[model samples]
Target: MNLPPVNIENIDIKLRFGNFVLNVLYVKFGYFLSSMPEHSHSQGSYELHYIPQGKGTLIAQDQSYPITPGTLFMTGPDIIHEQIPDFNDPMAEYCIFFEVLPGDSTPAINRNHIANDRLMSELLMSTPFWIGTDRENMMALFEMLASELSIQSVGFHHTVTNILEIIVIRLVRQYSLHTSSLHPVPLKTLDDSRLLTIENCFLYQYPSITLKKLADNLRLSTRQTERAVRKQYGISFSEKKAQVRMSAASRLLLSTELSIYAIAVQIGYTSQEQFSNAFKRYYGMTATQYKFKRI
Candidate 1:
């Protein structure tokens, strides 16, 4: 995969590729003045964010969500989102952007339009589409991310990459199990094989996703899916998804240096308050409190 043209604009977005056949890039995770305005890159590259401290909101097109400590977000390329701070305390987060190319015999993930930009949308498909996190673990992950970012050692790329995979699988299992409250769809409807297929695609990128394209891909109604998932799992779908998303986010926060706002956008939230409200509802303490307690 072609990395964005090298420039100071992305100097911190460490890119590691070439003879290693690697395409991994990461953003700083903590303590810096956010110099860039709220805009987005048009390049189609997969991205993930982990928030460890402070408060911020993510703005995307017409949507907004919060980015608080212990929040982890992952989305495909062309997702136009920007970070918004809470204006209270220092902001901290860590993020990674990567591309997965197809391999032998396995149908290759589409690369023809990998660069097309539209902005990642969590609203395309129906309920149980796979996305979620928890509150307590989310905070723990956030602290871990901050520590890792502070070290910033050589070959950190390898370490970061491995961590990223673990985050991905945690996310996959969470969402695959309908553990996200941000996705709108309830967790009650995730039992069918179809829901699993959709989430697998989102995580593994097994099938190419069209830009802002989600229609007729699901076989359940919002109510039906929610009901079914709850019946099967014995918990509301939204709660489960949020629990999962929050947990993954915590992991990211504990491991990266990306700012809080960036991490908010990487997750599905559009602003900081939104993220905070959701987080507090789940964890009781504020993002700031969680950060301090961890230290």
Candidate 2:
């Protein structure tokens, strides 16, 4: 009855992982379940969309990005966008739009001019974004949001806001992790604390990383550094670095509509072909195939 009250386990999991609580204040419905015409977010309210089935192309601002099942797309007050679904495949999505005042900590509105203002153009060029997630974690977040919104009782807004805030923060972390790896490093590590700190930095910033540099930062020999990671993760440092880079690469291909070239640069590959080859070897599929698969 009542669709079994949705799934509350998802709510608990999301809450446990993110420590984010939100209340939805309002919602605007869409008319086209089978088709979405050209549209835009030119005002203050924002929209969060999650696709569960099918593939499509979304034109956000002036740039177009492909979309697929499990895709999450968010737009803020400053942008305009349209949805172009792949009719060949069935599409299922959960989306909602709402507003927050100035100073609100919302990703859709809290970005810099380059991002919030012209993200479409930036996305078109090669600026990387991130959203591919650990499946359990991602599912928990989305299911919780959907459950919170399904409520017809009182005081829903506050709960939805808390959820949205938490989700947006996680998305921001994803973006920071993916982008920083492509960016630069600020300092070197010299101790255990510093090493952990450096590791966190690499994870967040996506710095070009190496064992030699890590050992130099920590004043250890390269072999010592390799031994440490091997001892802890049961994998060689080389394997670990490759694993992390691959993880980031997979995220870029999925969460973003970035081209193979753009995604390559973000994940430390110097060229698109190199990235494609490595991705195929590791994932057993080309980046494009992998991206469309929604794994």
Candidate 3:
């Protein structure tokens, strides 16, 4: 699909630990049928490339990496890179160019938070080049961005900004996984975005997720984590977790033919009996009854 290029001059993007202002130079989506000449970004600039289909080769500073469907890579400041698509199966790509800038002001609540952001920024800046496959399944996000830009519906700009921010965060996460030394430190304050990330853990990682795991992910103490969840969601952590799991379970029951035991396991319940009891308490109907009633 043809997507109009998006140019964002200056916008603040919230990261896991802190925020950064960025200029999104452009976003492009197309099947690269022609080779791109070797180019390097200016200082503080990065170009992210995602290939959703076909094959290509990326040559970065004399090193070549095979690019296939689901390939993702980034060329940062001063990294020479060239793209050559295979003629037999030209690669479709989603490319984003942006320059990261320092935030206007850093909060004074915790020096550690600032340090964490700095550490992440430094990591990104120091790594001039990286090539890897997409682990976050960002094709859907790129498609959504393209759709929003093409349609230009009400609030499209806001939606586009949010999607771009998420793309940046997921990119950072990919880098963090490779750099074992990088770690999240406890923050003195939790912002709404960070709180939402914490809440989404229950949605995405409900199975085998724990309070300690959530606390560690936030780099906060368990008590502080619980307080944050309650403060933002107006409910206890367990209640919120149940709400997410039950909602998911209900969908599974209605949408799929999975057995109750399987659905219970999928949603982190130890047994069908336990899941049934919880579902009944939450929805006033047994698992089977709910399924049949909906049917």
For TM-score, the strongest prediction is 3
Between candidates 1 and 2, name the one with more favorable lDDT: 2
The models' CA-based lDDT, in order, is 0.44, 0.51, 0.71
Worst 10 residues of 2 by lDDT: 12-21
Q: Model 1: runs farther than 4 Å from truth?
A: 1-22, 32-36, 105-159, 176-295
Stretches of candidate 3 off by over 4 Å are 1-19, 108-116, 176-295
Ranked candidates (TM-score, high to low): 3, 1, 2
Q: What does candidate 2 score in Cα RMSD to the true structure? A: 19.1
Q: Which model is ahead, 1 or 3, in terms of TM-score?
A: 3
lDDT of 1 by residue, 136-221 (tens): 25555434444455565886546655554445445433443322222222222232244333333333331233212212344556
lDDT of 2 by residue, 182-249 (tens): 22211222332433433443454443777777777667788887765554344677776676677667
- Tens-place lDDT per residue, model 3, 40-105, is 443455688888889989988767899998998988755656688999998888887765655656
Quote the lDDT for 152 in model 2.
36
lDDT of 1: 0.44
Where in model 2 is the C-alpha error above 4 Å?
Answer: 1-32, 103-136, 151-161, 177-295
